[model samples]
Target: MRVDVHAHYFPADYLDLLTAHGSRHTDIARIPCAGDAEGDIDARLRMMDTAGVDLQILSAAPQMPYLEDAGNAVEAARFVNDRYAELVAAHPGRFAALAAAPLPHTDEAVKETVRALDDLGFAGAAVSTTVLGRTLGDPSFEAYWAALDDRSAPVFVHAAGRDLDSPQIADHGLTWIVGAPFEDAVGVLHLLRAGVPTRYPRIKFVVPHLGGGLSFLLQRIDDNYLHYHEAFPALPSTLLRRMWFDTVGAHAPALREAIDSFGADRIVLGSDYPYFQGDLYTRAVRYVSEADLPAEQVRAVLEDNVRAVFDRL
Candidate 1:
């Protein structure tokens, strides 16, 4: 079964919450397809069919609610997860989901994570590379990490578009173009330095956009680890390999870099959907099938790696 693990679908109501609390850079959350009587699910399904994707595991990222109020966060999270669950129920095999947690509020986020996974039967949960200003490695997220580890949930890490605190990426519209992958790289590296992966071994973390060029830089990091041994209990490359990644950009050379960095068994197909609609979406799925990699590796990235990353999927 071909699964587009990194697909996204924004509910209209949820979009409203994003605007109400914060702009969430609504421009990024905007779906290219025109809205319909059925919320355009039919249009999306047709698009998926054309792309040869059997299923799409939808996620709400970059626009995730990283609210300050736990109460408001819970409400927003429930609304998003409920909407996602409704889509999965409406169309069985055609779609699956990764739940959105109202994060930066640890306890509430943990409760929502459990609800999204255990009650809603979501494959896993999606989080931003940084929640508000706190990196995934922040001390406040320890309970959140432990809870997910206990359930062996696959955590999808996406870049929080508007929340990137870096002044360098702020100007010249770099937020979407350069900020996405850069945040992924910085975010995961923070966790590696914090030893979150080693601390919570069962948590299956999935970084997006070819782990934001980490494949090409792992050796450099491993070499530098000797000077920073006090920060990490394990090698940076070793912990990163334990995480999973997706083929969103579908750059052949970079995918090969990721495979060399961490075998294809740790990679999976991700269309990024609406952003790469039509021909681009088709290419996202087709690239793996037609890559220069070995046949066994191709099958693993297209199918087997998904099962390995999310046992519940």
Candidate 2:
């Protein structure tokens, strides 16, 4: 059961909505969204086949159209989740979907999350690191976190519109040079420091792109904590071992380091399919296979861990 846990899909109607209403945080003009409905599914499946992926779990692109009002956010989430459910029902074994919820609007997000799980039969939910320009650790989101923890569903935190106005974005382009990984790292650090895992232990988080440079930056974060314990003492776990990572963009050495830091069971296979970085599944898997990890460990990451996290499907 070769499962690619981290993959994205954009239904046409959703993209149309985004295009109709301009995004506040992200430059939707740059991000290529699926304009046609059937083409998106066809392209995704073709890429999965080319990459030798047996199953691809589809998640909404994290930079969901921003809802100016909280009420609209709720309605938008319902619409997105319904579309995702339709996709999963139409294509049974070939694909599964993670529900999209209206975030920064906790009540609505939680309500939609329950519907996605109970009625739509989605495996889990996908949330961006931040909602309405606020990080996941915001006090308003405690209820949302609690609900996800109660359900024991995994949340896929994708790199979305964070620090869009940062100096890096001005200097370099958006794809993989800096913005994506930087946003992911910042989100992970914020979640850990905000005591998310400590507060909601059962709510598992899967960070994509090899945890977005977290494996290399753990020591730096710990060093800063050592120096400034009084100021920033809320380091949730001991190290990067608590969270799960995906081998989407990690190379051989990086993957080995992630295994050493987080262990094999904490790692899973992910491919940012239908994106320019989509080929990472074939490329990174081949690289990691050459590292001579035991076959069982490979299988656990490539298949079993996904099943464990996405058991609802």
Candidate 3:
């Protein structure tokens, strides 16, 4: 069973709410959302069939509005979670959703997360990499982290946007291309330095985009820790291994490096589906197949690891 863990779908009601209320990110208005399988059932199923994907662990587009009024954000989150529940109920085996939450609004976000898991039957919760300049490692989220850890829930950390105010890469479309992955890297680094994995050992985190260059940066991070131990304490290699990564990097070399760094059991298949970067669903599978990995390792990447991560589904 090939499970694509990183697919995206934006509910129409959520879109309408964002559009009507004036989106914080202007680019959202220009994007084609409803046309994609945000709420459509047949279209997504057909694409999954074509891609040889048995199931898609769906999530809202990472560009969820975190800056909206708390009340509006909570309402939007409920609408999306309800829609996800409806979809999962309709197609029990074909799809499972990662519930959206109104993050940065600590109390509301925590409440929505519990509701999404307890009542909505979602696989887990999906959150942006940063919440209003606060990374996931920020101390303010202790309660939220404790809740997830207590439930042993899997949290999918997606890149929403990057520091656009920075003068460099300000004009180009680098925000989506470069900034997105950079945010993922920064988030992972913050989580590592803040000792989140060690602190919340039971909380399973699924970091996107080949762990935001984590596989490659592990040496640098650890080497730097030796010099800056006081500033950022060192983390054990085992703790780092506890985090899961998705197979979004289509290139053979990159995927090979990820497998070497993270091991196959820690990596799951991901096609940033319906997004331009997700166009390589079949090709990603093929890349892993042709990488000369053991047959079992490939199976782990495509299916087993996902089931293990989102076991509640």
lDDT winner: 1
Expressed as tens digits, the lDDT of each residue in 1-313 for candidate 3 is 7888888776656777776666666344234432334534576676677778888888875656565589888877888788778877878788888878787787888899899888777788888878777887888787788778888999898886765345465577677677777778777777777877777778889988888778888777777777667345445345568889988867778877888887878998887776632245567666777877888988888778887888886
TM-score of 3: 0.91
Clashes within 3 Å, all models in order: 0, 0, 0
Query: How many pairs of residues in model 3 come into backbone collision?
Result: 0
Q: Would you estimate the TM-scores of all the predictions?
A: 0.95, 0.89, 0.91
Ranking by TM-score: 1, 3, 2
RMSD of every candidate to native, in Å, equals 1.7, 2.7, 2.4
Point out the higher-scoring one by TM-score: 1 or 2: 1
Candidate 1, superposed: residue stretches over 4 Å from native: 34-39
Q: Put down candidate 1 lDDT per residue, 49-84, tens digits, no spaces.
A: 998889988888867877877777878889888988
Better of 1 and 3 by lDDT: 1
Best by TM-score: 1
Query: Model 2 segments beyond 4 Å from truth?
Result: 24-36, 230-239, 276-281
How many angstroms is residue 37 displaced in model 3 relative to the true structure, after the best TM-score fit?
A: 6.6
User: lDDT by residue for model 2 over 1-313, one digit each (tens)?
Assistant: 7788877766656755655555543344234433234465676666677767777777875756347677767766777778777777777787787878877777887888888887888887788877767887888889888888998988888877555448668455564557777788888787877878777878878899888888787777777787778333364236357678988775777887888777888898886765543565467555556767888887787778777677775
